[model samples]
Target: MAAITYKCPNCDGGLVFDPSSQKYHCEYCLSDFTQEELESLSQELVHRKAEHQEPGLREQERREQDRREQERREPGGAGAQPVLYTCPSCGAQIVTDETTAATFCYYCHNPVVLAGRLEGQFRPDYVIPFQIDRQKAEEIFSQWIGRKKYVPETFYNKKQIESMSGVYFPYWLYSCRVDGELDAQGTRLRTWDTAGMRYTETTVYDVKRQGTMEVDHVARNGLRKANRQLVDSVLPYRMNEKENFSMGYLSGFLAENRDMEKEQFVLDVQTEVRQFALQSLQDQAGSYSSMQVRKKEAGIRDEKWSYALLPVWTLTYNDKARGKIYYFALNGQTGKICGKLPVDRKKIIILFFSVFLPLFLLLMTGGYFLG
Candidate 1:
């Protein structure tokens, strides 16, 4: 469950983080509070879990208490019955996922970040703030669809365009130094002609090279329910710009803890770094006409892992006419957009026949005249 929503000290209104201002804002009273101030006011709520445990407990009881606390600290999808917390301003019960870090109240539109959701192991190490605000996202979405010709006009309705939100997707960034060697057989062809007889010979040579490479951030998105393909299409965040994690940054925006473990993706990270090392070695063998890799050896000398939140603007359009859904995603930091676009079948067929029929008739008439 979320710790609780922060209440405005001046007007008793629910406070929300504003991405534009990068501070908690109260529309009711026009008051602004820094995240530090809010944290100070709600520091006691972080220990609310301890308030429920019994003062004196047996060994098994203490272990059970510890396990329960660990479960609360971890991120997961709660059952359909979401844990509900009452909005401090409106007393409205706010339903949320078990792992959600921040959300806004539906009744009062008060944006609140769950202070406890970002505590301990659940905390992110770095965060890339939303560089592209929602207003810019709307314009980018408009320009993107305007360039796509075959999309049904209904797909760009005002409602569909306005539904986008800035979400910080969870990711694990792995950095490591890799040193490896690659072995390959490279072939170069030699041809010669003498006394009207041609002879061709192919020379095969053993090739090997050693190199070192550093991978700063190999990112893996964390939400299990999010479409991996769609999420990955907007990749390659600028790790150089990431800031140390702060719950204050999450106030106005949506953020979440990772649902997947880093161990689950360790092999994938290893494969990526190894592939880079091997490819670098192969690039050195450019003189060969063709090469086949024979052996590979790679190892990570040092490994570092960081939990981060990367920004993404996503929109999914359900095309009712074709009974298919099209997803459009943009990198909130880079403004990169990618998705599948549906083509108009009827228009394609008409254009094909219209252009082909004239050419076919002209060829037939010219043949008859020549005959």
Candidate 2:
């Protein structure tokens, strides 16, 4: 596998994508380049890769064969073996799992994108680049943590805060059109007083509604091994801001290739779409005292599926004392946050007594004076 790293044209320093400036920056040279400048450089790198592709192909094939042999030798077929890539800058071995498309080199501390993992069908159709930079994300996290009074201090310490990572999580975006028809019965009641006597009348009517509805950009998590709750809580990404997929956008972040396919979510998405169509038709059934649906039908058409990568900042804290794990995720575009924080039981106990004890003593003293 080829581990590709973007290099600064002037100083040859490793280039990282900067979210705040929307440009690539070289740490050593303090120089920034726009995407246009990097496009030509990328093309040249492709040409160079093509010129020396034969040896890399042979090495990849040999590694695959060895992995297959190893799997066969193990009982019940062991899972996929870790893949190794040589870092372009420092020549250190970068070890990663099958789903890891981009990561950092531990020895050299430079970002590397595994180009082979994201080529061909594995490539994403769209990417929402990180808008909230690391500093902004850390500030947001701190503000959120500061609001919770009983949270443990260890969760937001400097060491733990430094562990936060910006990642591109894979998702499947679904869009479709629905043709729906609804049949229902509605009733209205009328009451009046005439000549000192009460009169009542009830009327029933049949209602029918038919319409076509368009639904777009329903996202579903596409990585199977990820935590579904953590990934899903930071939803509602602005689809309008998405840009065409480019490997350069992933330079300074961690990214994962999707193992799950769109087919896995088709049934669930279709059911949700149908329910929404039916409910919408019912809502238009007009004003009535009571309405009951007699028949409803919906047909989904023109289904569309898009593979995309969305940005998130994630942190994990393990509360070993309680044997529990807490997760924190922030939306990289909107700065929305979702987290599970460790509560300090001692603080809660103190707060409980501090407020109620004073009130209790005042009540007792007043009762004694009245007696």
Candidate 3:
């Protein structure tokens, strides 16, 4: 309903969260405040407004709250339409899609969000801020493409490169401890030669192994609509560095709400933990030519899942003729990269014919002439 800006208490300037400093920065006054300090200050503002405002103003605010809640719960609450606002820093008009919770201003480059977009299911419990910046990401991309020369000239066009945006992906991070047991029949083969006679003997043993193992930081993407495989490929953020959720970390980046809940990933998390525990005990099963595992149980005693935002650099490009969209992902913290790259059908065909044609001709001539 209104443009809300995080204001600096000292200078009343628009405050932006800086990634390097992990603090809120005032663009106009250059004041810096710890994230906790600014949060406390925000709480103070809300309390002062409620206490000092007139009764008529309070009534209006209450009515507005009711109206907003009704719109969200009613049919076709809010969809498709992007929120429009002017940047408090440079007065640039900005528009963001409905699902977008956080993004940067194009003109002034300040991060903006419709505070409503980050409530309830859309809110993140923790966030891993971007450690890799644009220049380093570009260098990584360049190194990746420099080795492959035939990956369509249009892939690296200025527009597609510029579209490489830092995005916070929603993930369900799980930690669990499983007490597991494994049962299997293990076999050992023995061979002996004596007096020109060969003899073979097989020894079999029933093995039972049990142990407790803990798995931490098992991640699954929470957005059903996004490419799950692509998201999984980027994997493995440094979960140890995760910090409490705050809008300051999301500044100057693109972010979205989690479309799926922790419930969706529960089975997957349990399954992974089970497999890990089984393998852990299986490693202690001694030596065998082959062992077929029979019963394996994780007995997953405990599990915890938290909604987290992991950072990634996302580059998406389309092959219009092939009608396919390709993605390149760079780990925002570690700079590890992965993606699908298009293959040139023409080059493959040429190489195939070059290697196979001469051999086919030689075989044909040898068959006819030698016959």
Candidate 4:
């Protein structure tokens, strides 16, 4: 198999996959390809005999042909037509198929995100947009520290807080249908006395449950740095709000496509999907004292996928004293917060002396008086 490289249809320059638009785009010629065109072109090259050309040359041709075919079938591909934007400061380039309000520069991390970029290929089906902006995110972080008794004074002050940033993390959203079958043996204990003697008895019942669950959208983080639990705690995002992918929405945000492909997570995700489906079944089970799930099986059905951007605010802090890094995450959509905190050993010592000393002294005085 030859490696493929897409070239611009217009100018014959290199092309690459544009996640925001879900298309192959040419930076030089500014042309787009749909999924159909991309697929068809991809297929033709695979079977078609190549002339006596170098492997590199043949690979490049296949890539360009694939991009054109992709644009034909993919709705988010070039056919919808997006406007491209370039940043003068960092030379970061972006394109949006629809109108967007803001855009950011991927190269220099500029936040000049335009307001109109959310309507097109950059648009998110649903946005857990930046409800906790940088400033507010700092405040929330400081408050989180304040809750910790005996935290170092340095940890609470504005100097440290100012270093915090609200970063928008990228993630993938998946939708699937789930069917679950679970079997277990439930045990009920009974006690009875034979005459005056005590007797214990137990009864076991075979339990079985089968159900269907429709999972609308399950999200998995695309960035390696994004903490899975912290990101998940902020759920559930309003998945219903997701719009088709448009490049415009990406204009102003720090966005990334899934670093890990969709198939990589299917097994891990199956558990969550089954849990959701089983919740309904357990509710239906009603009045069981305790249910033990024994044998269980889940099958994902009617699976369909779309790439989307969810929202999160992440901050990383280095603790010099502890020689470790601490992270804080906030749910961009729900404002829920979860993260690790630095514990000060000095403060713990102070707390112990303050509380335990007085208690010990009082105990000693009472003993002396009583004696």
Candidate 5:
């Protein structure tokens, strides 16, 4: 397929898709067109209307017809351009009409992506482009693996470590305002004296509490198989750096749409929201010698949700003796790293006996001798 380029109607300068506004904007003349207009023109040339027409094909036929009709309104019918690509190697989806000289697969770590297949099957809203390039990622990975004394030496070598990728993991970000109210019993202890004897008394009081908090950008994992715990451990991404979505920045990297829907993540989000509400409500209770929450009610409201692709780098290594896999995760955006590694049982046992045992014996000998 030829490299396609969209030209502006007013000035004929090159036009590019603007993800922030979801419009095609011409950088030269500043003319803007909706994505529908741009797509209709590009699809017109390839569409020949599927071979067999069925009886109940009315709905599909109508939508197709409407799109075709809009194509006629486009300025250039025959010369419209395409702006997306698909990776044949790993099924990575991308959008960049310009040649991506080099590309890597996020899932399979393949270096090949056929240029022809990237004809607009998948698109992304925004991309947090690779701030830490491949070399930087390797450096970070090595420093991380070095701290693991029991990690196999082979795992940190160049050949094995190059497989590390700067992948944009998918996620769903939800922003909402929360309001909650809770009631519980609070207790306090007091001492009383009667004649020569003293007795202890317990006092209980009714405690009522209410609180409100606004949360911005609570993220839920969009990849079902992804370990949320691992993702969270590397968190505190610089959310302010996030850009509005666009396919252009995905030119040489790998990304995927959120296969998991917003509804599927509600249960997980509710769990976090409840914990946040509980903490805020507890703070409002001021000072209580001890408090037991017997009954609780909390709620979430004014929620805004959207699918997002966040960045992460994962490294997995095998431990021979235990025959279990250990993994480490790095937050691609903020560079925070966290994960589990192999621990040497022999070293642990030796250290315990060599250090702690002698210290314990010395303490006992001193107590016996000095007593």
Candidate 6:
């Protein structure tokens, strides 16, 4: 596997994608390049990589091959293996699991994209790049934390704030057309008083509705290892704003490859679509005093599936004493936020006592004066 990094042509420093400016920036020399300029440079690097091979990289590949061979010889030894790649900037070994498609080198802090992991079928068709930058995300997090009274201080400290990361999560987008019909019975009641007597009438009518609906961009998480609730709560990225997938967008962010396939979600998505269509037809049955649905039929066709990468800003805190993990996530495009924060029990107990103690003293003094 080959690890790739974008280097600034002017200063030869590591380049990272800047969400605020939508450009590649070199932090060392403060230089920025547009996508067109970087495309040419990347092509040149590709040619150079094909021609030259580093000795350290060759050694790492040899070791990996040996490890695989040994695993094959041993029974019940085949399992997930770590991959190793040499960082071009620092010449240090970068270790990653099979699912990590993009990450930062621990030694040099330069972003590295594992090209092999994103090749062929694993490549995403569309990507929603991070619209909320690190600074904006941090500001939003600070404001949210400030509103809470009993949250622990350690959860929003400087170190924890810096640990927040921008990640591109894999999702499967589904679109389809549904043809549906619904049959129902509706009833209306009429009551009146005439000549000092009560009269009542009930009328019943048969209702039928038919329509076609086109549903688009129903997204489902594609990585099985990801926390479904944490990611799903921050939804709804602007699908209309999604751009064509470009490796450049993955430069500064961590990205994961999909472990779950579209086939896995096929039945669920189809059922959801059918239910939605039936509900729409039912709603069109008009306003009646009472209604009962008799039959509903829906047929789905022209199904389309596309793999996409959506952006999110995430922070996690592990409460080791409590054996629990808390998460904070924000939608990268819409600025929607969701979090599970840890409350400080000590702070709550102190607050409870302080308020009641003052009230209790006031009550006792008032009673003494009355007596």
Candidate 6 lDDT over residue span 1-371, tens digit each:
56888888988888888989888999999999988898898888878965797879868876765664455336456525676789978989998875788999999999998876676677899999888899999999999999999989999999999999999999999998999999899998899999999998999999999988999999999988899998889988889999888888899899998878899999999998898899888888888899988988999989999999999999999999899999999998899999999999999889878998788889999999999
Model 1, range 1-371, lDDT digits (tens) per residue?
24455678888776766655657787788999876787776665547746765666445555654564466545551232366767655778777875577877788777777665566677899998777778888898898898876676666779888777778889999999998888889999988999999998999999988878887989998777678888799999888988888766665667766778899999988987888888777887678878988888888978998999988888888867778888888998898888877677776777778888888999999999999
Per-residue C-alpha lDDT of model 2 across residues 19-110, encoded as one tens digit per residue: 99999999998999998899899999889967877987878866875664455346456435687789999999998876788999999889
Model 1 spans with C-alpha error above 4 angstroms = 1-81, 183-185, 192-206, 292-295, 320-323, 343-371
| TM-score between candidate 6 and the true structure | 0.89
Provide the TM-score for each candidate, comma-separated. Answer: 0.78, 0.90, 0.79, 0.59, 0.59, 0.89
lDDT: worst 10-residue window of model 4: 114-123
> Whose TM-score is greatest here?
2
- List per-prediction Cα lDDT, in the order shown: 0.77, 0.89, 0.77, 0.60, 0.62, 0.88
Off by over 4 Å in 3: 1-95, 106-109, 292-294, 343-371
Per-residue CA lDDT of model 3 for 1-371, tens digit only, reads 33346777888766766656767788788899887897798789779978999999878866765565455445567554466767666788878755566776777566675565665555678998887877778778878977875677567766677789888888888887888889999999999999999999999999999887777878888776678777778887777888998766666678876656688778877887787778878989999998988887779767777788898888887888899998899998888888888767777777778878878998999999999
lDDT (Cα, tens digit) per residue for candidate 4, span 215-315? 77778775554567776767777766554543323333454433345677777777777766777666665454567877777778898755567656666
Give the runs in model 5 whose Cα sits over 4 Å from its true position: 1-127, 190-206, 227-232, 292-295, 318-324, 343-371
For model 2 the TM-score comes to: 0.90
User: Which of 1 and 5 is the better model by lDDT?
Assistant: 1
For residues 234-334, write the lDDT of model 5, one tens digit per residue: 76667777876543434334444343567887887877987888778877886767899877777888988865567777777777677887777787767
Worst 10 residues of 2 by lDDT: 70-79
- Which regions of candidate 6 fall more than 4 Å away from where they truly are? 47-79, 192-198, 360-371
Cα lDDT for residue 206, model 3? 98
**Which residue pairs show backbone clashes in model 1?**
17-252
In lDDT terms, which candidate is top? 2
